[model samples]
Target: MNVRHLIPTAAVAGAVVLGLTALSACSTSDAADRRPGDKLNVVASFYPMQFLAEEIGGTHVSVSTLTKPGVEPHDLELSPRQIGGLGDADYILYLKGIQPAVDDAIKLSESTHSVDAAKLTTLEDHGTETGGDEHGHEHEGEGAGADPHIWLDPVKYAEVAKGVGASLEKTDPGHAADYRKNTDALVKKLDTLNTAYKTGLRNTATKTFITTHSAFGYLAERYGLVQEGIAGIDPEAEPSPARIQEIHTIAEKSKATTVFFETLASDKTAKTVATDTGLRTDVLDPLEGITDKSKGDNYFEVMQSNLAALQKALGAK
Candidate 1:
């Protein structure tokens, strides 16, 4: 997928504002001078979230990313100006724990007018709904209970897109109809993609697979697949020696074809596991950032790539 093809010129225009000088100014007053009809001020935590907001908000919204491209969302620290952007935003979309600085800024921005996409979308409690117990919690380690990467899963992202549209409509009620229409269209696209995954991955030759982290809980639960990971909720957490040994044993016993790692985190541990088990390593992007090699510009292409990877890994036709 060509990213340039997926992104509209308007989306590219929005990204133009994210230069070093703009990021350096990070002042609320600077954002305030831009004028109201110029665009609805919106801030998204990372790439996927930013893309969704841009898709739904369209020309009516001017979207900015709180976390810069190529920067790890888990390790992001916000500048005072970035925090001011959140305070000035009509809506701020972010995964709860993926960027602690964003989360903290949202708390502070609440004193003014701003929307919290996570709470508005009710994504924080997904584990319980799916019969999974891996609830998000705060930790000093990399993005605990905040699996801010939920947008990687198409199904979850559809819901988030819907929430973003609804929130935008609320903030700018004049454009509510357009927002709803755009959101509905995007949701239909997501549904089609979801069906493709269900048909492509269900009842495949391989049922068990290993990942570097536990980020796929929503996707696994959505498709009746199982993913065992070397680490826990936090990708930064190292597996216990016993846990690593257990994963190795499981992979050997299950004849797992490949071990998957993500783009945002280090692959050293995953490489070690693959070497120990003699399994091939494959990428399963968490959609945290857009790499030069990424198929397309936004989350949809990344998700399609993920499905293709899974099908290959699972030995599906």
Candidate 2:
């Protein structure tokens, strides 16, 4: 599933330009301790990341999300207030390439010395494939690289959670021990969730599913399931008629019982495909937003809900 050709050159260019400007305006300072009446101000790209930060940081940190709830992350553009919030925060957490707008805000925050440029543990641009059923699509450029939905997979997310805990400890050494404790608890929860997914998805009757976009690569690979997406890496991509037809054929052949759509993105394509095939369409959230139907206002709950969805969709009794 190489998707390099699908990486929008214009988006990358815009991100680069914004990053440079933001970085240039930022000022760096020696990391300092939290003063009396100070709380660690943290900013995240979207709901999932923010939820993680809030869960781990607890009473010590105040976390905010740059992208509003229910908005497609790829289409997000920071408002003046959001940009200002980034500069005022003590730390900003985001997955690169997943949200270019947040990346730009991080760069800008660097210049203003409002927030420390946190070290990112996950290298997003790697070309490693989270192997499942390859859909034989030739992506030309960086889009063909690895999928950025690492948080959807519990194993990868545990690693990310650990990294975040480490970063939080570094930012506020006074709370290092507490951060480690929180990390351990969060990791345990994630481990339980991982076991649930493996137990639920293994031996399911249907191993292949259809999605509105290529956001479930990590989940599908982790659970030995395959995904056929109508769109590419960019959620906004409009599938060609032929591509849509091809997905229909693949879904029919794979015995796909459900067509999954994301809350933050359009469901028109998924609905059309489901209608044509007479299969049900359901929401398989990417954890990009906090929707009313989401299990709760957090990542772990959302992942749990997704596993339940998979179980029902695959007919895993």
Q: Which portions of model 1 miss their true places by more than 4 Å?
A: 1-37, 120-148, 233-240
Residues 1-317, candidate 2, lDDT per residue (tens digit)?
21323324455445545554565465422237457657777777877688778878888888777777766677776555566555456777777656655665566455333222223334342233333246545431114565667878888888888888887888888888999999899999999999999998887878888776667777787788887666656444556767667776777788789988877666787777777767898888888788786666678777778888888888896
Candidate 1: clashing pairs of residues: 3-297, 26-81, 136-145, 137-145
Worst 10 residues of 1 by lDDT: 1-10
Candidate 2: stretches off by over 4 Å = 1-33, 111-132, 139-142, 234-238
Candidate 1 C-alpha lDDT tens digits along 51-169: 88888988888889987878767666565556545545666777665555555556644524455556644444343222232223221222323334466567777887888888778
TM-scores for every candidate against the unseen true structure: 0.79, 0.82
RMSD (Cα, Å) for all candidates, in order, is: 8.3, 4.7
